[model samples]
Target chain A: MQELVEVRWHGRGGQGAKTAAQFLAEAALDAGKFIQAFPEYGPERAGAPIRTYTRISEKPINLHCGVVNPGYVVVIDPTLLSPAIVEGLSDQGILVVNTNEPIEAVRKKTNFQKGKVGVVDATQISLDTLGRPMPNMPMLGALLKVVPLVKLEDLYKNIKAKFLKKIGEEKTNANIAGIKKAYEQVRVG
Target chain B: MRKVVAMTGDQAAAEAMRQIEPDVVAAYPITPQTEIVMGFAQFVADGRVQTEMIPVESEHSAMSACVGAAASGARTMTATSANGLALMWEIVYIAASTRLPIVMPVVNRALSGPINIHCDHSDTMGARDSGWLQIYCENNQEVYENVIMAIRIAEHKDIRLPVMVCQDGFITSHAVEGIKLYDDKQVKEFIGAYQLEHSLLDIDKPVTYGPLDLQDFYFEHKRQQAEAIKNSLKAIPEIFAEFKKYFGSAYDFIDTYKLDDAELAIVALSSTAGTTKVVIDELRAQGKNVGLLRPRFFRPFPKEKIVRALSGLKAVAILDRSEAFSGQGGALFAEIRSALLDEPKRPLTVNYIYGLGGRDIDLQQIKSVYADLEKIVKAKKVKDLINYLGVR
Candidate 1:
């Protein structure tokens, strides 16, 4: 495809935005495509966190800057609903927010352009499968359905790079389940 | 040998990076610094420079990846402004202490209190003690030259410290200036092929970098970096000599304009240098012997050089971007005072805070700074109004 596709991932510090990036990078490797994966941070001790992103392409990635204006934005935490974050997302951008609310309900809370919103009970899914509210993996699954740049096999590789051996395999399987479930729930325009 | 082309400071730095052909460049582009990485990526994509540009998500990853690459014996580079610089602050210290010659072009801008994307020294001042060789440039030419010099300085045998070539955000980074571009063959001859040593990527040896320095060794490890910085001061003149020989246009620790027989002087850096120069020249043409001392090298602070130059002068005025929060003085003022402490007769050095938060300081206002210097010279004592000149 000649068109560029970008994914914006929102998460807190220590929330696996970095790990999520690793998963996406590995996934691109799996798909035999080169990838760009990284994070935006602050002093970011424990409580304060930030965003990360991924771009997978059959050709070598040429973009060297941050995802200032993105085609897709993934919010792993509901708390990051700031004016700046909402403002950065493009008009036709797909938003994959990791809250338990249905896409319609969260749409009502914010004045974000309505047509391309994807909401998932990612927190609920994480709590169910991973036994925590860490939506990085689940959010990645949700992102696959929303962000068109990267593929499922790419994400699987991303999971491998992040978790590594045995625990990684289990996490990988769990993430695949999360992605599948999230994929089913999201409504695309 | 002197050719001038108009370009932004960011573009100049990127062009310099293109000449060096670093092995890896990981950057999260923010405003001001965005053009730099973008231009460098162009070089990589065009096959003009065979290098890997790591497309990281944030300034933190950008710097972290630079550390990883430099440790692995790759010549690494990156660029960021304001918020991006702040994000990379934590790792900046590590890059320096690890003694990896990673160079970052810091487009100096104010930190957000009111969400500004304009020029100031706030971002870089915050990074002062990050153990990086901090160099400030007046315009695009210095930004272009310093980036090349930074790699040479950082990779020097006696000094392998990380370097921060600070340029004013919009004033220099985005502002177009007529810069002399060097030929590829000439630049290649200047910045020779990088030789990797004790690198992680060396498969034969397989060495580990960034070992945790415990309480006993921590101070020593830091001392080593400090020593590297100190030694860099000695090595810089030699490198710059070579730079001048190759490039034809020379540089110095400080550029002094007409202070020889002048009674008053204005000491400053960055784009303010241009402002001060015009003001001084105007005052001089009108038979007022006023000079401007623009510090090209900020790290070793050019203390002896400044004292030698300023001691002969009757009075001096210092300008700063940020408030010291210490007294009726700026950070550069305080540093100058500390430097001139041993001098037999220190000049009446007054302090001024101007052009903060992206407020434009035009020629008219810059001339007023010279008037203040004249008043300070007459008073024979340093005035400490802690003045804010630009905006409300």
Candidate 2:
């Protein structure tokens, strides 16, 4: 059987890659898929590149290992465009990179010969909207456009479940606005 | 009824502990073993089980917390692995010698020098002399069942020693498999109430815990603890029978598979036995006489049973993960050789040190183990054979 629509998140350690993976799964979990979101540990001090995963399926996941093959590879940091991270992009997979650069340049660094490439200047979008250079919210918006399994409403509901509990409503609304602007600026394949 | 789900060894242990309803569980996070503590932490967070979960800063604090909790007359539990267990080395013996029935799951990992994390029996091997009732599980399913059974064995009126339900670190702790948890009613009925009244902190009935027991009175107390630990030998089978009557999972303290007429046997503990069984069966199909003797409980090591089981075999290979620096063989080899000394007819026993420092042991290595067994049976002088899951 085709398993969960698995997505791999690539970013530097301080850049909220694990948070992005978790929020993606939580958003889709509210849509009723049994999801597993986990971060693979690394030397993972402040700025080391980190890899994480989000898998959304109609069935329970028994495998807790890394996402061996992914449906979408979301690179939160464009500098992490290496073959090591994108090694197992499934034939029909999509690569979403957060950079103002051309799609082919990003594609040149990856062995993902079959992925439909997406490029977005998420830092500029986040700073313009949320006033922080958090690429997670915007990269997620790009991810939603490419993978469309989860509705926009479910993402906010799940984000509120996480952020609203930690920060207040004002910061949550700012994040939601950042996500909204991301939907407008984040490129579609 | 408590639900059936696919879970790792640690998750199953946490769930089963909840089902049996321990009063307090204090544990700290350590790799391969962290999952168990995290599982219980979630239980404490969700309030699915009404057990007090204490989060400690380190393994020493975790064991210390468990000692305090158990002394206060609560059925307390905790978990650790490798160096973490090493860190708790002094306290583990104290918990056992004091006769506190705290059940812990030691997710066995390699002890560190170069700092690695994976599966091995070396950690528990290092703690073999610590007097804890050690029960090594062979699979994810057994890890769950053994956690429940360990509590029963540890808490038996005759046996008040703390039990360590051990499994190979990531191999069992992180590997997901199918397992059924007992319903609260069944587990509650099976384990019954934890009937102890020695609350060290109770103002109404004041008591002292861990007061220095000098040789005279303390020696007898140590003897009594040893007696309690030994009494588990009988209780293990009886409790297993009762558990089988309810849950239909019949287990032996020492499980002997096809040793009946086998010429050779490979003995192992923890998750290695699962893959070893497959090797045993494949070799059996080819008419090669090989079997697995996986001992579930280790403290009151089934010395008589092992001697009796090996009576008919021509050769035995004892696999040990922990090194015995001063000894001629690994610790397990010494124990097995010492136990079989009284047997009238015995096999030529060999010691094979297969895994250390969390090296992966696959079915290929298992198959290779059988070939070594064949050679040992033929020669009877195959001592100190190091099976290299590590060398490569």
Candidate 3:
């Protein structure tokens, strides 16, 4: 296993992409991995393009800049997809997209030929399970399929513990369902 | 028992505040710094602490309230960033001159004209000589520990000065990372209790604070304050040793990463040092004698130790996150250049001002810095002495 793995996330504001990255880092920490997760801040507004990053390692992750050449690029919004999304992805990297499109089509559309790709119908999954179009939780589920950096069981426990009080059990359970559904339904190539 | 948890720098600092439970927290929300005071405010709301939460109208008012609270002999704290810190500039100096031990977590942000709320040292660097003790951290864990340590450092009788526990805004402030946290009991026991020696509220032994001091005693009072900061050099090691004995993380005024026998080195502060360390490891593997020196204490400057560390090196690059625009170099570059004046084997030194307005400093850029150092070493002379890195 690689000692360090860097992941970049592309999404729009208010989509919880930052939150998903936070959860991923926290879950990796739960698994005893040193992790850093942060979102790029700018004069960005809701539904505008934004970026977030995560770095997980067996040792304390010391690099403090943004993730430029990422081992995994997780796109939380299908509309935000572009060739630039995978511009600096490592050759052995994996790109995960939250789209209903087939894996082959996502690869073709993004022109992400350098790395392995995964696609999930996260929008549909979120609408089905979460009763909304928030793709953040589902995207994390798809990311888990591409890179087992954190355990799903641990993520679930974390989600429950962090959100159970503020968001209540019902909404937390919905997010958990959204995660599981996306995990099972994601197609990797 | 200690708990290991994943959290951001702001959250971690707030957690430390919760443990310390200072008498007052005067705060105004600013980007990047908002999370810290917000988290602390929640603690106040939930009655997790007995802190008097003063939600002031503005940053100036926030600092003013802090000065008032501290003068009344309360263990005082407040947080701000960028313009917020700028707004509190007047009171910031007074808090120090009055010898009030108010602690503040300054989320490092670029001061504005273009109005950016990003990670940079400009905020704290601008206040370097404001009579406050400044400590920078590379990550969330360090920020947490530094805030806890800042309390002791600020309140020390020998070093009764305000302290700024700074971490990179957005980078470390917002970034979630795994950190080991001491138990509440452990933290409480370690910090012990803060007892104010002089209080305006002490009717029987009253003393005036921030009173009108005309030129007659102003210079003398300032000299005394300067002497107090200089004396803090002795107090820091004592508190640092005690902290390590109890908490098990030994910290020093300056942290040297692989600098031993290094021909070239990079000097930086805050999160940039973390990235520079990665570059150092990569170069070390390639048999390059390179290292990094991060100054944990910036106010007292750690002049003697820094001079000793860079004396024998072939070349050194001082990286500054804030621009002095002095046409010479950044503030750090100037200080370091002055410090190395008496060194017999002074390394060829250059300044690289970088990461201003939260610009991303990749590993390649850090490598280029070392490459520049190598060139300087071979040429036996420095060229373009003050340069910019990761900037067009």
Candidate 4:
């Protein structure tokens, strides 16, 4: 990983975009790296579009403004994929989406030709594993496949430790299963 | 042993409050600040702290309850944001004038009209003269540290005043970052125990709290309060030194970043200062000789420390997150300019009223401010006394 890696997550309200960003940052912190995570708050309601940011670095992060040029953009809701979503992404930045569509189709939708694109059927994966439509965990799995900011095992340990108490054993295991499935199935091109 | 944990500024404040384990916590929930109340409430529910948590009806009631609890000789604490702090205005002043050592973590937010719930310094800046010590924080770690230190500052023998530990709403309050927390035993030992000299609950010696001394001693009493604040200027350093001895991180009224030999610098506060440091580093990498001076304490304004830090600078841009509406400039700009009046060789300073109403101030905007400072250094004068940055 580089000295600093900034990731922006685009998701709708109630989809856990903010949670995913925080989870990634916390996992980075557990791995002995400095991190920051925050959501761009607005007049938000359920199903409303929201953006969250995560920054991981070897050194302390001093920048407090919104992440403008993110090295990676994760779109948890496939409906949010657009040219605007790719705006301000670095030329070499990677875009990951939780869509059942092929990587080519996702790239065509976002017009994000500057860098590689990763696609995964995270919506289906979440439904199959968690028995619910929570793509946040699977989307994070897809993101790590492209960037590998934190090791998969470390992220799994963090998620299990963080969620087991709040979500209980069965749901926590299911969430972890979804992550592993998405990690294995995500296709990047 | 100190523990490093990733938490938001609100969480950090609550964690500090948990460690302090005040006798009473009377607060009403407000956005950005709601998390602190919620986090502490969880601790209370989980039996982590022995505190009487009061879920007040309104912010007015919150401050009123805090005043009551504090006067009764119970170590007290509370948390609120923009409108919440404004709503507590009446009791807020009373809490300070009555000299109750209440500590409140004010998550900075813009006051309403159009009714915005976003990051701004207008809330606490408005209460600048409410006779409370105001300590601004740059990040979650600072938020945690400042809240702990405020207990000592507010409850000091010479400085029996309330304190508002302010952090930028959402910017730091909601942002999660790694923070180092001291052991509960260490914090307890550092703060010791609150022992009010004249407790209202003391039956043997009755004391008057809010009495009307119309023409006789009101002026004299107010003078005593003024002296108390001034006394803090001397007492705060000793407390800070004590904190450093225990925590290993030194704090001061003002924090300077590479400003000693720099020709250009930016003066800012809270999270904006953190962002400015990044810009300073980038500019310094290109040999721009730029730096930053961040004021940690706003109330009892650290004029001497600030002026001393910017002494050798050729020019500076003072960034204000809230407008003073004085047609002169923002509150910080006014304070900085006034502080430089006595200095024979002071930096040519310009005021940039930016980030009002929670508008994002990016690195480019900060860099541009430095660029303006460089221009001012060449011109040897400021073109505009008050300029707006990142504003439409």
Candidate 5:
């Protein structure tokens, strides 16, 4: 891992993009890493495009501006994929997408020659396990597969503890299962 | 033991409020600031703290309720942002002049004509002269610490005034970061109990508040208020010393970053200062002698400290998040320039108004400001006294 890891999340409102960023930061924090997570807020309603950022560092992170050249970009909405989504990403960077398409098809759609691409059927995984189309949890699992910023067990523990109360035990268990499945099934190219 | 937790600036302020648990919190929700109130309101609902949460109809009523509560010898607190603060404009001054020790966490946002809700210093800068002590925060930790410290600063026997703990709206307020929170008992013990000598509810020795005194004594009362705020220049350090001893964290009126040997520097406030630090490091690696001076307390102005910090520099740029429209420069530049007037060897200073209406101030922009300062020092003069940075 780099001295500082910056990740950007592109998702529509109500898709839990902001929450996913927060979860990543919180899990990083629990792992004794300094972290920051914030959303680029605007006058946008549900289904509107939104971006959130997460930074994890071994040292204190001081930069307050939005992450432009992120080392990793997570796209939770497959329909929102475009060349703009991969802007500022380096060839060495990683792009994680929540999609049913294979790596070749996803690469053709995004026209992303820079960096590696990881694709997963997050919508199907969430539906099978969570009984819904919320892809944030599975996206996190895919992100960890491509770039393990935090330990997989640590992320699982943090998520279980965070959601077990707000969401019941059954849903939390299903969410954990979805994450584990996505982590195993993510196709990176 | 200090608990390390991940929280946004708003949550940090709310957590501090929960620990302090003032007698009254009268607030109306506003975006960015809405979370602080809502988080505290949750504490109220959960019975985590013994606070009378008043869901006031408007910011006007909010401040009015706070003034009434503070005058009645109750420790009061509140939170608001841009237009909500504008709505509380009338009572904001009254709360100050009445010598009510109210602590408000102001999430700095742009005042609206187009109705924008994002980070800027315009909201608090507009109230700079309202007699309330304003302390700008750099991050979530500073937000948490300043809110906790403001309680003591405001309620101090010598300095009985309101305090605005200002943090950038959505920038720090919405951004989650790791912060160390002290134990609740230690915090409670540090703030101690609110001790009012003479309160409105104290029927034994009643006193008048906000009485009409047109020309007869209004001037004298204003003078007294001025003196009290000035006294904070002395009282604040003492409180800070005690806080440092108790919390093991030292705080000063101004934070200077790598300014000791630097010839060029940027003076800014809040989160921008953090970004400036990153730029300063990058510049320093390139053998450029540049630094940053971030003022935490903008109310008492810390004129002498600011002057001392920039005394030996070749040139300095002052970054203001709000455009003062003074035509000359922004609020910080004007005050800092005035402070440097008496100094014989003050650095050549210019003003850069940046980040208005929540425009992001990137590291590159800050680097350019340093680059401009380098040019100013080389020319030994400033071409433009007031400059707009990052504006199209």
Candidate 6:
């Protein structure tokens, strides 16, 4: 029974949170760790709130239910930083959010006050590097900075392998650049 | 070398189908189950396998096409969930009664009226008496393996009946997990080639299928079908033994976790069993005598083995994901209680209807169930025989 790290992601339908969870899980698998990733399914509309989950362990994962008390909570949509998003986060949990605001200001605004919080301007990074505001990969960058679930190089390699053929070299490179920027720029409070 | 990859349950089912390369796959897209057929469809479009992929308009037509194809001696498969399974209700029974040996992957979901789409056992439980062999899976790997075993179990010479390998809908179907796959050669060798004793396509031996029968002959035909299902109880383990020899995982009609010498135990199915296992481990660390029995073979109902497992327990809680609405208890509870009715050492049985329509059942709720079982054992009376867990 290896230690299991459970993560829950809060984002909107179009924010690619589900994609980020899947990417992290795949990267964990490539790093020789067992992982489980899945999104909560509903009548998803582009801007509607969406929840996704990921579980990483050295042992094969068998529990197949939603991650109620997650070790980490990743908020992809800044607007979803409400209390409901952190409902079941453990006391030692880390809350990572994609926002341009300072970590202290974001914490005060959301009144989250408890866990170790990590904040990054993923939207700004995505816009600067990828020329679009897709914060999914950048958020993953921020998460990796906080938890180190998989090697940074492994995540980059996974992104390249998955998106190189599907989305072409230019977009892939931009996405990777965004992730690196988020990794470097993230601030923990 | 075995190929180990990360895949969702749906993807694994489709991958298994790709490995099998059945003669026909008639399917319609539905949430959760949609990806399974979609993945197989992609394989067909890419010219990976030579399966005749039939894109049916509805689930009813999907099963109908499978029955037609299977009757013509073609190895057939299909997939559905929730309303899709309900839509194919008539043909579901027909495929089994006609003994078409059609193997289907049923992504277990809640049957809709309020129309919520998530994981539950209602859809498959509704078809419990439909004569198809039902195998519940605890994870994506089991879903993949069960589909492969189902092909062997359903097509066994003595048990030529349809088989449904059921997995929890979004929980297993949409979740990505690491799974080891057999090489194409090993899977092919295990299944061998498909054979039909009597085929509609055989010009030499003319046969009629789905013909109308009145009360006189229908009852006997149904009895024979019943006999085939009973024979499958034996055939399933035989296939499981052969599968373990090749794949190296021992699967049985029932799976037990720390139940050899336990006073309190739980009986559950599918993904819930995985959660229950974790709770059992946590309780065992605290020196609680709690264990679990997961029934893989839900159709023939494994009466004797289940009774034997529970006969010594002081209290046993049966968890049902679907409500039987009998005002008494859930479907599983009813069956287990009846199975232990005449046993001299029958444990005090309780029913828990939980996780209906995809409601989440967490660790606390599971622990609470165990606590209730302990209380029931101590009090020497079942205060509330039926309980609802994790509901408002």
lDDT per residue as tens, model 3, B1-392: 66789888999999999999999999999988999999999999999999999999999999999999999989999999999999999999999999999999999999997889888888888999999999999889999999999999999989999999999998899888888999999899988888888888999998888879998999999999999999999899999999999989999999999998898999999899999999999999999999999998988889999999888999999999999989889989999988998899998899999999999998999999999989888889998999989898
How far residue B364's Cα lies from its native spot in candidate 5, in Å, is 0.9
List, in order, the clash count of every candidate structure: 11, 0, 0, 0, 0, 0
Docking class of 4: high
Between the candidate structures 2 and 5, which one is better when assessed by DockQ?
5
Residue-wise lDDT of candidate 2 within A1-189, one digit each (tens)?
245688889888888887888777777666666666666664649889877777777775433334567888888888778787677786688888999887777777876666698878888888887788888888888888766868889998878977997988988888888777777776655
lDDT of candidate 5 at residue A107, scale 0 to 100: 75
Q: What tens-digit string does per-residue lDDT give for candidate 6 at B1-392? A: 68678899999999999999999999999987989999999999999999999999999999999999999999999999999999999999999999999999999888997887888999999999999989999999999999998899989999999999999998999999988999998998999899888999898999999899998799999999989988877877888899999999899899999999999999999999998898999999999989999999898789989999999899999999999889889888998899999999999999999999999888889999999998998899999989999999
Task: Note the chain A TM-score of all models in turn.
Answer: 0.83, 0.92, 0.97, 0.98, 0.97, 0.96
Candidate 1 residue-wise lDDT, B12-54, digit = tens: 9999999888899998878768899899988888899888888
Model number with the top lDDT: 5
Off by over 4 Å in 5: none
lDDT by residue (A18-118, candidate 6, tens digit) is 99999999998888898999998878799999999989998867676678889999999898776677787866888999987888876776667878999
DockQ numbers for every candidate?
0.01, 0.07, 0.90, 0.94, 0.92, 0.82
Comparing 3 with 5 on DockQ, the higher-scoring candidate is 5
Compare candidates 2 and 4 on lDDT and give the better one. Answer: 4
Q: After superposition, how far is residue B205 of candidate 3 from its true place, in Å?
A: 1.6
Interface DockQ of candidate 4: 0.94
Predicted candidate 2 versus true structure: per-residue lDDT over B71-132, tens digit per residue: 88888888888889888888888898878899998888878866878666778878887888
Candidate 5 residue B349 Cα shift, in angstroms, is 0.8
The predicted structure with the larger DockQ, 5 or 6, is 5
What digit string (tens of lDDT, one per residue) describes model 4 on residues A91-169? Answer: 6999999998898888788888869899999999999999989999999999988878999888888888899999999
Can you tell me the CAPRI class of model 2? incorrect
